[model samples]
Target chain A: MLKKVHCVRLDGDKAELEDEIAEEVPLVIFVNGKHFSTAMISPQMREEFVTGHLFTEGIIDGPVDIESLKVESNTAKVLTRHSTTFLESRKVILSGCGSTSSFLDKKKLPKICSNLMLDRTMVLNAMKAVLRSDNFKRSGGFHSCGLFNESGAIIVVDDIGRHNALDKVIGFGLIRNLDLKDTFIATTGRISSDVALKCARANIPVIASKGAVTTLAVEIAENSGLTTAGFVRGNKMNIYSGGRIN
Target chain B: MLKKVHCVRLDGDKAELEDEIAEEVPLVIFVNGKHFSTAMISPQMREEFVTGHLFTEGIIDGPVDIESLKVESNTAKVLTRHSTTFLESRKVILSGCGSTSSFLDKKKLPKICSNLMLDRTMVLNAMKAVLRSDNFKRSGGFHSCGLFNESGAIIVVDDIGRHNALDKVIGFGLIRNLDLKDTFIATTGRISSDVALKCARANIPVIASKGAVTTLAVEIAENSGLTTAGFVRGNKMNIYSGGRIN
Candidate 1:
């Protein structure tokens, strides 16, 4: 998923040639033979991305909601339960590149009823693990996402887009039938409303990151009963919503 | 149009409450009274966003191509010379959002044949200025985009997305009829192929950032004859393409 490219390194008066970069590719999705969406993503995790994208976009409920998902070179064809009826409508263009869905309804977030409490140490460890991943450590061009329980990070995924990282981990949880109600997510991107809302829709109660948290994200998380935290560096962090951290 | 929100801070055992979070809003754009695109943005620079988005997406040629632009609370209406005919087609979704458009063509970039030699000091200073902007320094939620000539950063824009920031500065340049041949862009987001291609299409020869540059971005910049640089910090930087810097 990562690649190296020749580059010139300039450190003040000294200059050297090196190769250290990540790979990005355009992946177009066709739902039931109809063009749905196009994403510029890291070449890995196509299936997880499709499942997570479909679920979060409200296109399909879960992995089982699809009859078949075939990923060819840079393209994925998903046959969802709603494919035929959904394909009748026009393609809805979403706002940004992380995860764009025309079906996102922020006002109608699914109620998440989880009593999960996040441990600061676990969150810190998860954040650290994302930065320590081979993908990030090697190329530093990917965003990392970690799904954690009470103990620690269960799985970590790195993607070119932070939204896709969250989706991959969440989709992984959904596929494995993990009890997401008892789980939380730690990512390496800013806490935007879109990110927080994704966790809310996925029923993941806690969203932690080592980046800034937007006000809309805090409001949505607070209303939707999701814990939002950011700037999870070293031993300090800011909790924007949900129960106060001890 | 930034807003402040209250948040909780945690540092081990001590906790404090603060209200220092940045605001984010969804802005939907309509071209010729038809739905064009929707974006989650910082709420300012809607006109610039629309103009830049239309131009970058190949919807419009420049500011002159737009007859009028009206921005409501959370929506932007654009009347472009090609809006009527363009609205007849379907909406095309692009990957990752800073102002994503369906009309971007990467393989056919406009040739940039400027004899501009990037000044190491100028790039360094521009990067620092973006980080030092009040929006970034205060909220840290906005990505900064700066357009620089020989004098210095002529215009710097802060947006929730790096792509939007780039569009804003470029849009500003277009509206003011600034000569882009001698200009460059400095940003605070990773150098993706989409980004590098946008600058290449806009005929901006130099793209600098304090973030990682992807492999595709390097290849695209190299092939498009645009200079690319990344990891621009305190006293060191990485120049990926164009000319070797001393």
Candidate 2:
């Protein structure tokens, strides 16, 4: 996940330094033997990312919808039980942080109905734990996400893209048959509308971030009945919507 | 570019606080009367973003390739001198931070050829100038990019997406008929492979960022002859590729 490279450091004095950088690889997904999309990822957790990405993008209802998933090199071949007509019709390439092809209709999103409530200390600890990764600390180029409950973090993933990280965590939960509604997510990325929408689509109740929350994200969380929290650092956090925090 | 919202601030004592957040809107692009893509942007500099995006995505060679560009609300209607066959044939949704449709063939990318050299002071100053944005400070959700020469920052743009911010600055330079080969870009986001490719596509010789650089980004910069610098914090920087800095 990390590659060492020689760099010239300019800090009052010129010094040659070796730095570790995160690796980014293009992961191509094919559905029903047709090309779907290609994502530049951190090259780990390919199956989880593919599974979570398909679910979050609304391509598949759940993991059971996939008959088989095979990852060869950088390509993921997914054979689903459903037809490919839905994929062909909705080819709209939607862009946010990078470019996603998911067409997000706010009204169509399912409102979260989980009764999961988190305390201030738990949220802060989750944020801290999710961010505690050797890859991120070494490379400083990865965004991290984790699924957590009152006990601790269940699965933590680090990716070059925050969206991919969250998707990987969601996929992990789906594969493990974990109750996603009873869990919350903590991330190192901003709580954008897309991020909030992903949690809603996955039926995750709460999302806390170590960054700021966008206004559209706040609105979507409010309408979707999802709890959104941001700035989870040093015992301080701002709750944007769905006051389920204790 | 910003919106005010009510939130619950959680420190030691819970208090109701009014906060400002960055606005994200979907900007749909239509090329030659065909639906191209939709980008979630910060709702500013729509025209510049369109121009820069087209060029960076290799949709148009330059600003002259576009016959007419019209923006209504969030939709960008572009009439190009070229045929839409290129768009139809290459419908691959390439995802990095989000989803982009550009098929990036590293061998096909144009090698940047420029004699632009920068002193340490100038590069550091440019990074500082570009990051000095009121929107980012207020909303804390903006990724900023700037086009700079020895004189200082020519144009600085802030968006929810770093790719959009860089594209906006590139578009600004394209419209003004500026010599992009002589200028560089400064960004507050990480220097990923897509970003390095964007600068190379725009014929920009250098890109400096106050963040980390991916390994693929370093390879792309080195191969394309583009100067890539990262970790441009106070009084320090790391030169990853193209040693054009004194």
lDDT at B6, model 1: 64
Clashing residue pairs in candidate 2, if any?
Answer: A98-B97, A98-B98, A98-B99, A99-B98, A99-B99, A100-B99
Best by TM-score: 2
Global CA lDDT of candidate 2, please?
A: 0.84
State the lDDT of candidate 1 residue by residue for B48-155, as single tens digits.
887887787778888888888988767788887754444322333333322212223444556777878866888888888878888887777889889998788898
lDDT of 1: 0.77
- At residue A132, candidate 1 shows an lDDT of 82
CAPRI rating of model 1 = acceptable
lDDT of 2 by residue, A52-90 (tens): 998987889889999999997777999999875443223
